[model samples]
Target: MAGSEGPLRLRDWLVAQIESGRYAGLSWEDADKTSFRVPWKHAAKLGYQAQQDAALFRAWAVYKGKHLEGTDKENPSVWKTRLRCALNKSADFCEVRERSQLDISNPYKVYRIISEGTQGPGTILPLEGQPGLVSKDEDKQSPSRLAQEGSLLPATLGPSPLADHGYQAPGPTHSWSSTLSEDFSNPDFWLHVRLFYGTALVHEATVRTAEGCCLSPRAIPANAAAEYLLGPQPRMARVHFPEPPPGAGALRHLLPHLERGVLLWVAPEGLFAKRRCRCRVYWRGPLAPHRARPNKLERERTCQLLDTRRFLAELCAHLRAGRPEPEYQIRLCFGEEYPGPPDQPEERLVMAYVEPIFARNLLLHSKRLGSETGP
Candidate 1:
């Protein structure tokens, strides 16, 4: 055992960093997903230090337990997912949830002390499912609240696309049922449109499958969020919703189904189905993605946000046989420094042109979405 000092070392480092205001300069990510990004400069220190105190990583996990010094019998709703926006090699990535901001009262200190060493990690139960959606506040909100506060869908259509919350088959005599498994091994994609009301993430849908945003996915590992953001998700899921009839089944109506953060399957057109998963971050009109890259010397530079306006425009013209509407390619960019994955550049991207059915289906519902509501 590394004694109490093993975990205490980490606690000390975090305490010192807090004292020196390391967290004061945090990097932003897709809506509602805030990581306590380890600065690139500090990567070396954490790396060498981690080897010294192997238990350090245990203290860095997303653990849930009662406060070490609280009188209440129930655990306070405190969460800590250790991650930071860091280079893959550093292994220093960590997440700081909107609500999990640490104060001195945090129980991590007590848990770390009792746990002993890396191998002897105590019972600080780690979070199992999607770490993105684990915030206490989000737990309280039902699907209805999310729609009213976050979605662009009409009030009537939302809350639940299925009227009964759990709907039966079309006929009175028939009932269709399928069990949903906790094992989300089935691959899919989520199409996310995060609207930032000024700096606050008003509407957040992380890619739970591919159509949502952060505070968003299970497919994405909590530690590798930066890499996922900077690159395209590799999967064979082809997402397509049924085209609705003329008026009622317009983009707005289908969105309740399309962008609901779940995957829809269709029979393949041929031997294979098209698999394209692109994640684009849109800022209000005339605005670009926030630039938050750090120098190589000062920070590890784990990811980058790059824009894809020029390419999408040319492609739009060639495909549609005419120039796209003025509001089509509003000022938007890929949230990371690079667009698409390595050896492939054109695939994972889109322009927010609201024609529906095509041109980034159901992406930007309305042109004025960019500046519809004032900051």
Candidate 2:
């Protein structure tokens, strides 16, 4: 929703879009499937002008490598869906016609927009480079206004901007809540960890890392570690994971310990501990149900980066075979991210834990992590 805006009518936006398309080298029938997506530029521009949800229509960059805004998973760029929404409500002014009355006549599955004015509802706008079918109100514009509008047409995306701009596909029809505040510890909570590979690398690197990581075993040794390549330039390190004991079914569960995540914290400043010393919350299962406390006996129990990376590996596996809804989740506390390494550096460290809700939200901050947890 556009914050603080009054009520909206999809028809108004549709009228503006029709006008914008007319100004753009507008056409009715796309000569090929490739030409059909061209109108989305007008749809996106109108979205911005109307103060519509930026998530609904992410504008295309006129030049390469300029980051398009609004990159969250919430309300994905659905300009086409919005366009169809507006068109469905604007039947008096526009009509959608499949390329032919008989489906066999058109193999492309492309539909054309025809104006109510040109030849009633079925009248198509002239093909590109031909005279456009202007609406009655557009006749009021002076030649200079028309010229100014022409300069406003956006530069087209090539090599297909559909991938980044989302011009070709619709956002998913069903999803779960993006927020995570409530799911709690359960007997089944740690059955699987949700991992999100680092995001500091180029989008391509993110892809490679996730693909590379998803190949890990269903569960790793308690001390399992692997050398993963992190690159802006190559950076390598071995990260650790907890192995589930055998006979765990299609899923490998966390050991009875290490459930809510291995906590990385420091003793109170007056405790006379070493400089920058940190303490880990040992995985106290059901019997000793305390979150943080004075230590009892200890075993070499944790490595910080390893816990983070293990979650990453789980994410990859989830991609290959997880369902629409799974039993665990990955929670991301953006401003309240986990502390990474013993130094607990200056930037906030967001975390991904495998919980009752299987989430994959915090992959963006993983690459910057550079230290280890107390073992």
The candidate scoring highest on TM-score is 1
Compose the digit string of candidate 1's lDDT tens values, residues 1-375. Answer: 235633232333444544454242332332432233332222223233332222223323322112332443321111112222111212122223233333422212111111122121011122233121221111133322332343223433334322322211121221212222223321222222332222222232212232122222224454553434322222212222223335633333323322312212111000001111233232222112322321111111111111112222333343345445423222222232323345654322221211101113212322223245428
Q: How far is candidate 1 from the true structure (C-alpha RMSD, Å)?
A: 19.7
Local error of candidate 2 at 359, Å? 41
Q: What is the lDDT of candidate 1?
A: 0.25
TM-scores for all candidates? 0.24, 0.17
- Those runs of model 1 whose alpha carbons end farther than 4 Å from true positions after fitting are 1-57, 64-82, 85-143, 146-282, 285-350, 353-375
Best by lDDT: 1
Shift of residue 315 alpha carbon in model 2, Å? 56
Question: What TM-score does candidate 1 get on C-alpha atoms?
Answer: 0.24
lDDT tens string, model 2, 219-277?
A: 33223222111111111111122243366332232222222122221111000000011
